[model samples]
Target: MIEHRRIAHSLVWSTVALGALALTGCATTDKGGSSNLPTPDAYAELRDARGADRGRVDIFRDSSGLRLEVVARGFGPGTYGMHVHAVGQCAAPDFSSAGPHWNPTGAQHGRDNPMGAHHGDLPNLVVESGMIGRATLHMVGSRLTGEGGLLDADGAAFVIHAGPDDMRTDPAGNSGGRVACGVIATPAG
Candidate 1:
């Protein structure tokens, strides 16, 4: 039973969600460098677009890292193959049943392989039908959130494939079909 929540903002949405979670959780700036992060309008605004198969994925973290913003719609335009697997249970028809890819640094599977894979091997999402298929993935060498995350001791899930992550496949991105999914909870910043 892993449950953590904390999104109640009031101080101007908590100073714009803590300045977009300190520019996507990269907050270390004291006149250092690499600090222009701020983009989390709860996945960058894009209200329910008439159930074009539904969409709205917003996962956040601060100190400058981990950000997702899949705001799909009707799923139609191009590219899909997304990643972030490793259980959260989204069973039913075809959520690929949600179960693999959140490789907590076991590392391998593309990004130029070395064997050890799975860090939600992301790279493929372009939807644009009625207009909504947006993606803003950025987990490069991630820790996920405010305290070293892959969901900090038990938490993670976000899959949406069906094709396009041929990032040198091994555990995923043979990208054929998994359709849609989401369960990256544990943020309340």
Candidate 2:
């Protein structure tokens, strides 16, 4: 039963990903100069320090909130910490250019902390054998462009850590070094 459910879920996400890919080339802005709402969709191509393709991240906005899915490959099998960084720049080697975690509300790190669980806090990502990992249906209850929303003037990014998040440590949940990074941006950009 669990296997069946997993298959169904994978199929659903694959379809949605294909849909996003189909609309990737379309204009996301009010290009015609009409009263069209801005499409709050974005994508990111993850890369390792050596500039190799690590995977991709797709973010979709809905009425309730934002949904993000991460598909990763070519990494060691282990649980790793993931978060949305404040800056969009994902410089190679260390990716410190991505800046700190997105915390508009000034909350601390980790969901397990009493005074924490900031906006950028996300569930840990687990990679299994064959260098495959998928973190699907991560709901980020934040807007794309608005007060306290992501994609600010500095933009945002997603980072994959070298170790699992302790889920209680301040600042970074005691997660290890960053292994992969991706700059989040609209497909049209």
Candidate 3:
């Protein structure tokens, strides 16, 4: 189990690193002329089944793609599978309203599958004993609006699962039940 966790961590980080590299071309100089980065675009507020506060997810967008950052707390100490679901609704008590993983390209689940990796596939979230977890990911060829946008008519959502994503299974990677969810929405300020 310990080794498996380590492997998962490595794979996830590697994927993130590659995604970051891919975004380099779309980047520009920072305010201090240091480095280019994705700009903040939208966000979401996560809640559990009973509507308890969980955390927040922020979305950043560049010319070519979008990035997601999830900062959450009040979870048990362990790794959990986090994903972007198709529907934006996060109805309480079950979060089934969020629907399944966002797969506009008709791909399978997980980054490790031979013929898989839906656009919604994300790294596993690891929470330490402090009960807090954070993860950042860049999804290439995705947008917040326009054709095939995440905020289309049906909308989209972020969901945290009860178990770790095996990163190779079909569908949801057998990540267990939906523990928390949030609807992606643009800020109104």
Candidate 4:
């Protein structure tokens, strides 16, 4: 009787451990679904057109979704438009050359915009008098992947403007110059 009780207790504990493992596994995957996105090379900071030192951006994926954090410096005061622009090039002053917003589904601009919403259209970034500013944004699209977004291929670039992002403008938020820009190379090592 004693041996049988011990075996039953062991089985119960084993079952509980397996259940916990399953829960943890589910929590680590992306919210929408399992991502087939490739493993990113290494996270790299976006450089301004002049190659002057700008800021850095990092993207991470968890069970909830994708989180992008930007830490930049040397930007003057006033509100600036920050977003993920199409194409990885930052050669032009306006990033208009970077292509349209990073909208895979062809959505409009702004989170509040009723017309259309672009996947890459994020709120504006406000920089105080200081040289440094920070912005953190989140997205729940299943398309986000370490290889790039699940929808678009080539990849995308993060851009910082010199003016505020109206969030409803056609191409960009009518944001001024593309002061700083970084290509979403890959996840951090």
> Which prediction has the highest lDDT against the true structure?
3
- Candidate 4 residues 13-120, lDDT tens each? 999999999886656321223444433332337567778768777576656666766778887777888878777666655556666667777777776688856778
The lDDT of model 4 is 0.69
Candidate 3 lDDT tens digits, 1-189: 999999999999999999999898667632223345443588888999988889988898976688888888899899999999999999987889999998888998989988859889988999987888988888888888888889999999999999999998888889999999999988663
- Lowest summed lDDT across 10 adjacent residues in model 3 is found at 29-38
Could you tell me which residue pairs clash in candidate 4? 46-182, 107-117, 108-116, 108-117, 108-118, 143-150
lDDT at 68, model 4: 69
| lDDT measured at residue 120 in model 3 versus the true structure, 0 to 100 | 91
| Candidate number with greatest TM-score | 3
Task: Show model 3 residue runs off by greater than 4 Å.
Answer: 1-39
On the 0 to 100 scale, the lDDT of residue 144 in model 3 is 89
lDDT of each: 0.61, 0.84, 0.87, 0.69
TM-score to native of every candidate shown: 0.27, 0.77, 0.77, 0.68
Candidate 1: tens digits of C-alpha lDDT, residues 83-180: 77666655555655457777766777775576644667877887657645777777766775545456655556676665677778776758876666
Which rank order by TM-score, best down to worst? 3, 2, 4, 1
Higher-TM-score candidate of 2 and 3: 3
How much RMSD separates candidate 1 from the native structure?
Answer: 17.8
Error of 4 at 29 (Å): 26
Which residue pairs in model 2 clash with each other? Answer: none
